[model samples]
Target: MSAQTPEAPTVTTEERPAKERKVPRVVILGGGYVGFYTALRLRRRLGKREAAIVVVDPRSYMTYQPFLPEAAAGALEPRHVVVSHRRELKGVDTLTGRVTEIRHADRTVTITPTEGQPYDITYDHLVVALGSVARTLPIPGLAEQAIGFKQVEEAIALRNDVLNKLDTAASTWDPEARRRLLTFTFVGGGFAGIEAIAEVEDMARAAVGYYDSISPEDLRFVMIEGSARILPELGDEMGGYALEQLRKRNIEVHLSTFLSSCVDGHVVTSTGVEFDSATIVWTAGVKANPVLNSSDLPLDKMGRLNALPTLQVAHEDGTVVEGAWTAGDCAAVPDLANPGSYCSPSAQHAVRQARHLGDNLGRFLRSAEPTSYEHKHVGTVASLGLGKGVAQVYGIKLRGWPAWFMHRTYHMAQMPTFNRKVRIVLDWTLALLFRRELVALGRLHDPRADFRDASAAPRPKGAQKPADKAPQSEKVATPAP
Candidate 1:
């Protein structure tokens, strides 16, 4: 018999050891309050072997929106108001990209990076934290003329724009031109609008002292609200108090009014008032990020994710969508404390909901029962300007300095990290010791303009230089909405 080599053992596909299951990946969308907190919590509680964490957001940092007014008014360093995700969310993969579509049924999300081709990221668990955006109307010139107040960049641009306006108004001899440049109009009378106008007005009032031709009285601050009262969250009496205080500052408080048009710097209101305003700030309100419309997840009438008390995404039939969660301004979480009503979209609720959602998500991964999110809203507080504010806490009302102090204290405690808190405190201390920084860096808005001009091909001699483009002061730099 021919020497036959022992036949190699034939291993069937089924006999091979099953590939080790991959550690579950938790994908969090949006780096706002909920996304940041939830990722931080998961990384702390779960080891690498337990699960992998990934966060995707268009911005690498999270803006502490409550401090935006202070940032705009130069009371806080603009850098301090935003927390870097890469610095804070250690041990987690962070993708700076916009989530273009979410297919929860397939457990996959498509993210388009800031500069690259879109890609798909599959996750065992999905988190929808895509927060809100400025809710704007189709009013004429609004999209082209107004600036929003939702981010740090907008706040800084606004500060510069206001100062630039003052500069232009002071140098001009034309009364009409000066009036248009000095008029600052704010739409919406909610906390955001009220705080923004108050803070900027306060800053502008101080900045005007630098210009010999401008006085505080020469500056016009107008606030228009479609509702009858401002700060409605503070209740009728407190809202009334806020109204009176704003009026005392000589701010025009036009209640039951809406901005009908603002084309070419001309503003017309529903109440038939017309004026020319070079600066129009839109703080009207925020709506759930429109990206939700692209997702397969359940959403409420307001286009927000429908969430149960446990912060899990809920189906229309009332069953939870396993491994799916949501919170912050994007989620319509039922408010157990207020029956038949969902939690209000406020930083107060967003912070608490984020922490609670983080805890619940951690519990879910460990196969433990999730707890419902329940916290009575403590109250509402708003800063009118430096050394002035209004607050209503647990049915108690306060105004002026005491309220302002409380506003600072409460937000400081909730500003995210020790580093940020310390920096903000330093800013405040320095402000008390020195005058507010009144310099405007409007050029920051178009940093490349000069370079682009220099790079352009030299015009032919006698070309007239394109009619000597309008001066920066005469041009209104409309910020991102």
Candidate 2:
């Protein structure tokens, strides 16, 4: 080696090729309303040479959650209610993974992909939009038996499960079992709980016609609300109207009631009511995604990221954390329209906040002054069933078909992408022309179950079947040798 040293191959700093500057990368966490819209806006605002954008989420699509009730009711096709990120974010990179940790101090995030090893991605900017998850209580059997009504999958599963229960109930002869199967329980009385119970009950009632043994009277729909009223987002007047409408439809509305337990399909409530229900839906509420706790960001007492009205992550003193922005349910964004209050976690706020955050983020990248986000509450609308609804807009109240139409029109207009909008409109148009489909594809939840059963080891050739075998008592008693 000394002989082949060749003067140590001396090289100066100038001899090395200059290290190329990396294009600033913007890493967005989540693909919900905030993540998708921010990425889309950034792609349009920044050139390829200016910055690189990456969106990380476990799901590849953004679910239009407002229409989940309709989709579950078969008013709209399931596929039409979700938008594909890869299709929408043309110039941005989409990563189907979860952000395990965020080291904003180092400008890097750890992503755990569905498969493969975890990796760290360095970013010049970070967007926290992980959104919310079902806020479940520690009630007995909730984790084991109840299902949430958040994602499209859950909606579809609920639809199939309800229909399947109806099918089984129609074929069963046990009155108790039939009653249990026919009883459906919903926990919570917010918009989600009300809308979900209403839509699903509508579907089930219509489906009852297909089963000669089952009638609309046989179905029992129960709603349990811990609060003093349902649909509190709507004022007491509208809430009372909604309550009356649900009761008129034969739904049992339990105000100031809580689900005490639901062990083995036996539901016990705080109001001393008890029932056995085959289907239990938990739409109680939602909390910020817990993943935020893993990051070095400032969080409120409720675990949501502390966000300034400008959508930037900030300290309690209102000092902005450089290069970090957040919106949606995960962030405690101040409601500038309402002094001393924070924006409520609703789709209306989420969509508007995402757009505002996107604009502010773009301004940030371009070294421009950011503006505050402010939007007054417009109204609240809810679908009771296929043709029934309730709404309060700009201090005006609406009910019946007018409210239902408003619900559809507002959501359809707000849905992202023309492709999805057209598809959903077509779905509605077709729905108007035909009856709601009542088929239950229950196997969709466990598609491999049938295949696994079929692939099980076949009976050995010439092996005697259990039915073919002689009874132990009938077989001639042979004395052990």
Candidate 3:
């Protein structure tokens, strides 16, 4: 009677309070400049085991956006312009996934990978650096035909597409077809749009030398800006100078004009101008990644994350939201250098904000007060082509080759790791030694074309219809350059 069965090990509903992990998990969304630089700094600031840093992005590499125009113009190698996350971010977990939603109240994020089931990831701290997307208007065929200049892939595709169009123009005898192929329209007059149009125009002009029938004069490079001025960031004087420089290159700059529609290749603009063009580049503008709306974070009227000067997410009541941080194009961080103004969304602010954020995050993890983000922008520089550019550095305005040289030097000094810097410099050196590579690798986009063509060849008697449709490549019209 005394030998009672050993009481079954009692387990309470709240048994074994979930073991609190030893390391704080900090999650960063997006792998662009902000995310890349922040994670890179954090990797060095914290011990590998002290805090777990995870970076989630749809792209495995971060495209140095300032170099995108060069990449498109074939001045910089596409691969060198993009920094590989795995190669640069050591000891940090890299996730190739898109953050679908973030529930800050629950401290969890929903990540949908390129492949596989969606899963939730919990975090102690969150960094919202999910940058911006091409801001587009609701015009006909804009989404279907227009290409963006945001990513490296888009740059490569555009380069090929431009060259392909040139090839068509060279071979075609039809006036309408030649006109469409030779006409290239770019919308927006910001740094991105202007730089892209200028660089590509230079490339196209150079390429025409190789075509038998198409001449540089035959090509029409049109830029349609909605505002009354172009390069508004450069002030009225410099903006006017830029407009003059563009006109000298035969670039038609339409002020106070907006693209009305781009149905097929027929482009209509608010300026009462209509034209047919094979390629339409839309660098119009960018808005904060819509992913921010999926979270409960506070947003400004423009839909940018409301952030404090310290780079912490802020509440509507002007209070910091704890355990949250943001910078770059997504966050409207107060600009200490300019009173009553927020930092402009540019690489200068993005890089500096990242460094400050990483330092602050390290302090935050150690239960120390975080420092505020502050910086005076040094200058603005833009490359037009191989040896053409404009810059306003420390109030000193420069243009032509001198400005172009500064653009390269400034960006070269700032282009992430030393390896990348050296590689880019070497590329420039090689270009100086040899001729520019005008060969368009458009075939790269359709590598399986030969295989498909071989299989679709007229077979012997009675060829049955193929069970599965063979993948078709986008038809790229080639104009020699």
Candidate 4:
């Protein structure tokens, strides 16, 4: 050995020490608007090498909820309103699962996958943007019978259901049966209820033209609201304008009314209105996801995550919880623009908050302090069926066609990817040129019918299993025989 001391330092490439890969893990517990948008922005802010981002949602796609009404009306394709998370989230990991529990102390979340066994995922930071669910009442038959207007599936199902009812009403001979089939009741007066009711009403009215016996008059569209006013987002004047517009279309508007019962499609209202309606669409309201209790995170009285203006999860004493972030309907983020108030649970605020959160998260990861979230309320725009709408944009009130145009424009501008935007526009164009798809794909409801048929199919000679049956009775002889 030329130098014995050199032998101690000899090291092969395979034996050399490897560099440690230390990427912070971020776990987001929802694939809704806020969750998806935040992940999008976060990936842009921090590349894969910077952070390992994971999004968990029960559904593989994110629904553009604003266009749900249009989807129900058949104005836009249901597929166009949904963004596939797996395809869109290239840099981030998407999990089709639900966060059953969050152990904040250990910074771990228990994930229940759509398939396979549940597992625990540890994270350096966690975002609780699970969003809200349709709030239900104690009223009878509401859960069993009534349908919702939330997901794209719901929209498509509702569309087919409404069209199917029209078909049934047209064919049915009984007056009571016809009445029940034709009646459509919508609960709640917010944008969801109003837009859904209006759009579906338009579709139903158009569908009536195809039925020789059915007419628009036969289709009863009734809206029931517990509040005294509807479309409150458009302010008092515009809200009143929306109400008047809906009334002009002969859509019954019952205000300050609450649903007492919906037992077997017989809707009873607090205002003494009771009727048998085959269709009861509930857009009543949304409550924070009850899953918040699964974690040690602090929550408000309404069950929303207590979040600071910076969109960080906060303690009961209003202290920011480290490594925890939240936004959207689930987070009660303090409103910087409005002192002593929190951000309203709305899409606009959700998007803005997601942007702020993404920025803050980037800064925080880079060892910088997070900034506060602040945004002035622009206004609201609402569509009351085709060619009718109301809006208060930048303090300027608009009504009718102008408002409708603005509504379409604003939403088109905010409808996520350019791919969706183009597809939606093309759908609108095609709708203008061709007759709408009034045909109901009712089989979608029981899509397993084919499977059932297959299972009921006769088996091969040897594969058939004989059924156990009682002795058959003797048949009577025919008169001719």
Q: Give the whole-model CA lDDT for all candidates, comma-separated.
A: 0.91, 0.91, 0.89, 0.89
Report the poorest 10 consecutive residues by lDDT, candidate 2.
Answer: 472-481
Query: Candidate 4, overall lDDT?
Result: 0.89
Model 3: CA > 4 A from native: 1-21, 457-481
2 against 4, candidate with superior TM-score: 2
Residue lDDT tens for model 3, 163-276: 998886776656888899889999999999999999999899889888878878899999999999988888888788878989999999999998999999899998789999
Name the runs in model 4 displaced over 4 angstroms: 1-18, 450-481
- Writing each residue's lDDT as its tens digit, candidate 2 over 1-481 gives 3566456676675474545545789999999999998888888888877789999999999999999999999998999999999999998899999889999999999999999999999999999999999999999999999999999999999999999999888766568999999999999899999999999999998999887778899999999999899999888988899999899989999989899999999999988999999999999999999988999999999999999999999999999899999999999999989999999999999999988888888888788999999999999999999889999999889999999999999999999999999999999898889988889997997989999999999999998777956666755543121
Report residue 150 deviation for candidate 2 (angstroms): 0.7
TM-score of each: 0.92, 0.91, 0.91, 0.90
Which runs in model 2 stand beyond 4 Å of their true positions?
A: 1-21, 457-481
Q: What are the RMSDs of all candidates, in order? A: 5.1, 7.4, 5.7, 7.0
Best by TM-score: 1
Overlapping backbone residue pairs in candidate 4 total: 0
How far off is residue 338 in model 3, in Å?
0.7
